[model samples]
Target: MTEFNEKQIDILQVAERLFAEKGFDGTSIRDISKEAKINIAMISYYFGSKEKLLEALIFSRTADLKIQLENLRNEAIPPMEKIDRLIEFYVHRINKNKCIYQILHFEFSSQKRSVDFKAFTEVKKSNLLSLEKIITEGQDLGIFKKNIVIALIPPTILGTYFHFNMNRPYYEEIFDLKTEQDYDNYIKTDLTKHIQQTIKALLVYEN
Candidate 1:
């Protein structure tokens, strides 16, 4: 990932917020300029085009996670513990960067195949390969089940989290979540645990 100056970072952050609130097509470069408190030329000078700006935002957001995932292969911990850490890190990242995740989730759900999405696909592919390596390590150690569907692992985690997030109002009503703190606690504890257990159920060996 390229290092962004403070000005460029501001633009990317504003763009992320707008893209999450309004669909990418609904947001214009002018809209970003207004929200970012910068001139159109500055944005153009920093990012060239709306698509390139989005591509940069996605790369910047996922860069740290990619590094962490790559490092997991070298960790001395057992593969299952590494898996747990991965879930924890992913959940934390998604919560901390909700807007970017929301935009990516929307783009994926809409199946947009623009050139920008090609960048997203590459990022996802890299993350998936990192996960596959962890799973293979577990399988080699005889802790994880063989022939697991690696492709489904990400959707399992991401899809479940996205579904819960998108339906927050409904779930809050059903669960009597009265405060933002309550909902957040549910996410950090209950929701995170559920995802960890679900993934373990898929990967861990039986008996």
Candidate 2:
């Protein structure tokens, strides 16, 4: 018998879906409970409250990303390899956490912000430190073609990713996309490759 049960994970999944579709302001304990087919008290029992549940969701996602990045940081890889690993990790993580990303996009953009998403922030800071170190080391070994403009590197990488995943819906609206899968295919093959190449071109390839 496992200590954790499906009921608990179901509640979190339901909450995540609700948060994604309706935004945090529109999602409630009853909404989650009814969608999850669990009693409202079950959520409180498992995660304390809605606010705490949201925090747990953020922490869970960030912890996964932090682990992947930390593994790359420990490996004996060049900066280019690290960048490729980061891209792969981001794509996989985003695919796994699309609901959470949707929820975050809504809640952060809306005026009714409640909980502060501190979990990803810590992970992001740690990743930036590692990226800075990678850049410095690459420069020392003459593997890089530039100086210490490390501050621009992290945001450039992250911003390109966010643009692809988060900014796609509006683009889809402007264009005539058939389905989500179609959009995803376009991004995975064309957009992702372009972004990765652009990053390498901008940061590397001296003259």
Candidate 2 residue-wise lDDT, 9-127, digit = tens: 67777888888888777889999998888888888899888887887777666676766777787788787788777766666677668788767666667676567667667777887
TM-score of 1: 0.90
| Candidate 2 deviation (Cα RMSD) | 3.7
Model 1 misplaced regions, further than 4 Å: 109-113, 205-207
RMSD of each: 2.1, 3.7
lDDT of 1 by residue, 18-101 (tens): 898898989999999998888999999888999889889998898888889989867999999999989988888888898988
Computed on alpha carbons, the lDDT of every model, listed in order, comes to 0.87, 0.73
Worst 10 residues of 1 by lDDT: 111-120
What TM-score does each of the candidates earn? 0.90, 0.79
Q: What is the number of backbone collisions in each predicted candidate, taken in the order shown? A: 0, 0
